[model samples]
Target: MSGALAVIGLGPGSPQTLTPEAAAALDRADALYGYGPYLDRVPAKSGQTRHASDNREEGSRAAAALRHAAQGAKVAMVSGGDPGVFAMAAAVCEQIDRGDAAWRSLDVSVVPGVTAMLAVAARVGAPLGHDFCAISLSDNLKPWGVVERRLDAAAGAGFVIALYNPISRARPWQLGKAFERLRQHLPASTPVVFGRAVGRPDEKIGIYSLDAVDPSAADMATLIIIGSPLTRVIERPGRSPLVYTPRFVEGGH
Candidate 1:
C-alpha cells in the first residue's frame, strides 16, 4: 500500500503567490513535513499529522516524510519559496539516492513555486530583468573560498547577482566581504536592492548605492540584488523609485 510523496513550495509567505498545484497537494496529503516556521504557515487540517523540525534538520525531516509515504501515508513536504531552490527538494532527493533502494520506486514529485529572489525582484521593480545568477552567501555547508570565487566571477561577467542567505548570526561578515569583492569590479554608485521578508507583512525594501549600502540592514530573512553597470533607477515624486535593467544590452542587435 505505497503512497505518494509531494514536495510542495508555499512561495514567499503569501497565500496569493501559492500555486494551485501546491495548494491541491497540501489539501490531499495526510501528513505534512517542513521547518517549524514554514509548517506553521500551513493552515491546520483535520486529522493531518504535522512533522515540524529545525531548519538544519532537512535530511531527517525528508527521511521521516519518505518513511510515512512508504507506509501508505500521503505526505506533503513543504518548503518556503521554490522547493527546488536551496530547499527541501534537494534534501529529499539526496535521501532517496543514499538511503533506500525501495524509496526510488515511490511516487515523488516536485511542485514548483515562486522563489524568494523573484518575489524580491518584483517588489523592487525588475532588478533581475536581464541576465543574472543566484548565490547563497551562507558558508555552513561549503567553504568561504568557493563563495568568494563565484562572486568574483559573477561580478567580472557583469551579471545581476541575486544573493540568498546574506547574513545570519553564525556567519555575519560574509555578506560584507561579498560586497567588498563586487565593489572592486562594479561602480561605487551601483544600485543594490535589499528585500527583507518579501511578500510578508513586515517586509522591507531598501535601495542604495554600492558604497552607501548599510550591510547591517540585512539579516537571514533578506534577499540582496546587486545590479549591473547598465541598471538604472527612475525617481518619481511621492512614490518608491522604480529600478530596472534594460532588456537588451547596450549596442546589441
Candidate 2:
C-alpha cells in the first residue's frame, strides 16, 4: 500500500498562524520531518515519530520523508513558514522531479501556511500594498553576483523589497551590501523595516530610513523590508509608526 507525503508549513513559529489544513495534515501524519528547531514546534502526538535534521539538509530531510511514505507511513515534512517559499516544498518537488517513479505513485500534497514575509509585513503596516518582490540575501546556494544583480533589478523596478535569510554568523556582510545596492537607486530617506522573529516571544520590529538603517540589526531570523519610493510612514502620538506603501502611485491614475 502506497502511503502519502504532506509538505506542511507551521507559519512563523506561532500555533495561531498555522493553517487548518496544515494542522489537519499534521494530525494525519504518522511521521514528521524537518529542521530540529522547526520540528520542535510541531505538537507531539501518540504514534507519531518525529525526525529532526539540520536546516541546511533540506534535500536529505525531504528524501527521508519520501522514504517514510514509500514504506506506507503518512509523512509530514514541516517548515517554519510556507514551505513553497524557500522551504521543504521545493526540495520535495525537486526529489519528485528527479526521476523517482515511485514518488510519482505516492499521494503528495502541499499544505500552505503564512510565510514570514507576509507575517512581518502585517506586524508593521501594509508595506507590500503595491508592487513588491522577495529575495533571499544568502549566497550559499547561489553566487553573490547573482544576488547583487537581482537586487539591482528590483531596485530599478521600484519594487518594495522583502529580504529573507538576510544575515547569518558565517555571512554577515551580505545584508549591508544589499543595502548599498538599494542606495544607488532609492533615496536615502527610503523606509526600511526590520522584523525579527515576527510571531515569537522575542519578536522585535523597527522602522528606519535607508540613511539611518542598520543592517547589523538583522540576523538569520529577521525579515527585512526595504520600502519603495512610494512607501509612507504615519507616526502616532504614543504608538508605533504605521508603515505602508500606497495602493496607487502618486497623482490621479
Q: List ranges where model 2 is wrong by over 4 Å.
A: none
The candidate scoring highest on lDDT is 1
TM-score of 1: 0.98
Taking the tens digit of each residue's C-alpha lDDT, what string does model 2 give over 1-253?
A: 7799999989998889998888889999999998999888987899999899998888888888898899998999988899999888999989888846898899999999899889999988899999999999888789999999999999999999999999999997888888988999999989999999988999999899998898898899999999999999999999989999999776857
lDDT of 1 by residue, 131-150 (tens): 99999998878999999999
Global Cα lDDT for candidate 1 = 0.92
Clashes of 2: 0
RMSD of candidate 2 to the truth, in angstroms, is 1.1
Question: Best-fitting candidate, measured by TM-score?
Answer: 1
State the lDDT at 204 in candidate 2: 92
* Alpha-carbon RMSD of each model: 0.8, 1.1
